[model samples]
Target: MKTQIRLLLLSLTTSVFFITTSCRTELNEEIGAPQEQTLTANSKIADLILKTAMNDGSGDNILDGSSCFDISLPVTVVVNGTELTLNTEDDFEEIEAIFDQSSDDMDTLEFIFPITLIASDFSETIVENQDQLDALIEACEEDQEEDDDDIECIDFQYPLSVSVFNENSEVLETITFTNDEELHDFIKDLDEDDIVNISFPITVILSDNTEITINNLDELEEAIEEAIDDCDENDLGEERFIDVITSELLEVQKYKDNQSNETNNYRDYIFDFSEDGTVLVTLEDNDGDDTNNVTTEGTWSVRTRVDGGLNTTLDFGTEAPLNKLNNSWNVKKIQEKRIMLDEREGEGISKDELFFQQI
Candidate 1:
């Protein structure tokens, strides 16, 4: 009997200890601290994210709220006083997956204590057009969620201003970004021509609203060249030919046609847009019965307006699988070997969006 009682007591004690431990873990966030980019308009840019920018599971303490970071530093940014570093692209991606779902305001980056980090906030800043610039500015002006201890920190320190140029290489306007109200004002005054992807030496805006004044002349010049293309084309802009569109290595990429905001990523179909405006759609696992892995052919072209916001139009010839892509959609944006196209609200496209990347 004594031995049995002892055993029972030991088991109970162990159970109690475990329960207490679990409770502590559940409450750890309250006891401890928390931690937490951007466009290519919000989630597309992968390299710009840093591991240090993640939110502290609590969602209330998103450190890299502005998606701004200085990669040159070992520790990119601090969140709730914790130091973090990005070892790989995955580190940044993890943060992107978490905080992006948040509609709440984010916490300003906070250092552990007395630690100094000197680095250029963002390594590369590409303002593709006026819409992108507006998106970047709006992202920065977003208010940090309402809280008892939330800091009223905007993305930048303040007195932020940037120059806008026309396609003719003329200065259009130099607007100063101060608060969300000012951002709205800037947007109101924005013209389609002011939204050029043409010239470079552009001031890249950081997720934190911080600005890096023309990192180099190359990016600036590239942007200007793109602008010249548009200006030279009489504002209708030249076509993004099939060759240039599909020239991103090996000539193929997988695309997910997300309709009604739903993505069929698992479909994983390869879209091969050839130089002759022909599109070859292919998928694996041919059964020769019911659903053959047949290559579907289609035509493609870049339109100036009907596609709305200057993008490409695809005609899959009303075929079984190709009919889904028979709409004119704007180029959502392109990064390296990837191309994303989506339908604008006022545009004549009925589908949602298509995301393509070299698989």
Candidate 2:
């Protein structure tokens, strides 16, 4: 009876030990395994990542005239007989403003070369003279027959992390990219069968400085598609407004004074903006029987304000009611049929409004 009891107890102890050991081994395996989520090959999300990571040359298209490449600064360029050393991107606005000052003269830009040119893949080439630059530009033009594929309106806010997984769902390596160049190269070199996962939530910045959070690949693709057409990617600059304003005869649609809290309806006035810096204003007197009209002359110009905003200055020499619109009005909106403007007093927008519509 003692031998039987001892044998039974030994068997129970052995069974319990094996059960605990097997449970521990399974738990360890589960804990060591990698997450199974991965990005699909040639997916829309992958395409978006590639497109957004591509170099955006449109921002400096004013200097190079090629959407395929950008002229790296601190490059010196002569703008309308004024030599300007553009040290940064903000300086490009000054060039546009200078070009906007006059529409009659043929706007000229002369580059003082030995400048660096950055390509769509973020590669750089040093050009010694205009000949070399022209050759590169010609090549870019040939290579890019279609519209540029870079999505300029939206960009990933880095640094973003991505993990590469192998066939067994084991992590091969992980990388953190700090800029577009790194991210672009990684995507460009990816193999079709490579399993990759991006660590979210990532942030994307829109053209208007709006920030969006992306939790997954679907959300990222949707965001890119939605914001792809949100802004003017052509880099038309101030010239866009100049062309619209000069091409038509406009009439005062709405004018209001914030200081006096008064509104004026100059519906009977017709304003013509000539390309030669002259403005013709014709006023019609509304009577019960017949219409009498008076025409006046004014000088007009578009210039860059100290704060880099475009302003349209009007000087209708001592003319009643028309002279009230004489301030250097800041451009608020420029539409096909309407131009909106305002004047600010000191800190906040004074709300003194002026609007012109096509007649």
Candidate 3:
């Protein structure tokens, strides 16, 4: 009986040790093994953010910018056994958190719905990051320059021009001159439709090549219209007129001819006045296929009546021309005419100015 009791006790002790050891082994495995995470296909949230970054004024290449995000921590984006890093620029960490919470269980291969970018938390964070982003852009840019190829040059397709005239085709005012450096300085001081009065003497040539010097505004306007009406009417629609009158103006019409294979072409805008001072402007490309028929309806006014028309601030009304051009920028020089401004990581604006003489 004593031998049996001792054997029984030993057996009990051994069983308990085995059970504890087994429990510990399981616990260790759980602690050591990586959690099975369901990796979805590349997220559209990623794509949209990347698209915005591409146009973002930071000038960083979009692909390079995307690659810069290193997501090696609390946020993990896994694809086909490969893990990519997510850069923290633009407050992507917030996006990562949102993506984490929204992802459903499928710890390995999973087709998940896209992450939302419009959530209040995400939106606020994105906006804040965008505001502070300029501070961090310099460092990001340096990193990009080191890691990627230079960005391709963005070229403007058309040379632009703006000329003012009276009923007799008189050139009242013109801003289509070259001399980029000086023009840039000139435009910096003037607001839109704010008639920038200038008394510079300009030399004009008649259809007979008879050059006449005019110092007064009245004389200049008269001479300009006569030259335009009298210049070879056949060559009027062509770029030669622009080139002869306004030096350095690109022959966009001709240049576009070389790109005739393209479905979309530049739209021509001709702002002219009738005898009764009615502005009749047509916006259409004279050349190209039917696909090129894109036009926008817009209003026009002489600079004098722009921005409340020379009245004091008290008389200001929203209907004034200055109001239309309130926040708009103008170009005084051809070289400085093309401008590309990025407002945030994903939003950008580009503008190119062309100038032409009324003559």
Best by lDDT: 2
Candidate 1: C-alpha RMSD after superposition: 26.9
Strongest candidate by TM-score: 2
Count of clashing pairs, candidate 3: 24
lDDT of 2 by residue, 1-359 (tens): 99999999999999999998997566434433343335756776777888889997766766765556778889999989999999998888888888879755767788997899888789899999988887777666555434557787898998999867554544367789999999989888887656787888999999779899998777888899999888645432245456667888998877888756333547778889987778998877777333467889998876544333467788888867887888878777666677888887775445698888887
Query: Candidate 3 on 163-280: residue-level lDDT in tens?
Result: 3222233224555544322332333333333323332354544445566765544554455444443521221111122123233222222111122322122225433322221333
RMSD values for the candidates in order, in angstroms, are 26.9, 9.2, 33.3
Worst 10 residues of 2 by lDDT: 28-37
Give all candidates' CA lDDT scores.
0.41, 0.76, 0.30
Candidate 1 accuracy as TM-score: 0.30
Give Cα distance to truth, residue 333, candidate 3, Å.
Answer: 29
Question: Regarding TM-score, does 1 or 2 come out ahead?
Answer: 2
Which scores greater on TM-score, model 1 or model 3? 1
Going through the candidates in order, what is the number of backbone clashes in each? 16, 0, 24
**lDDT accuracy of residue 215 in candidate 3:** 58
Q: Return the candidate ranking by lDDT, descending.
A: 2, 1, 3
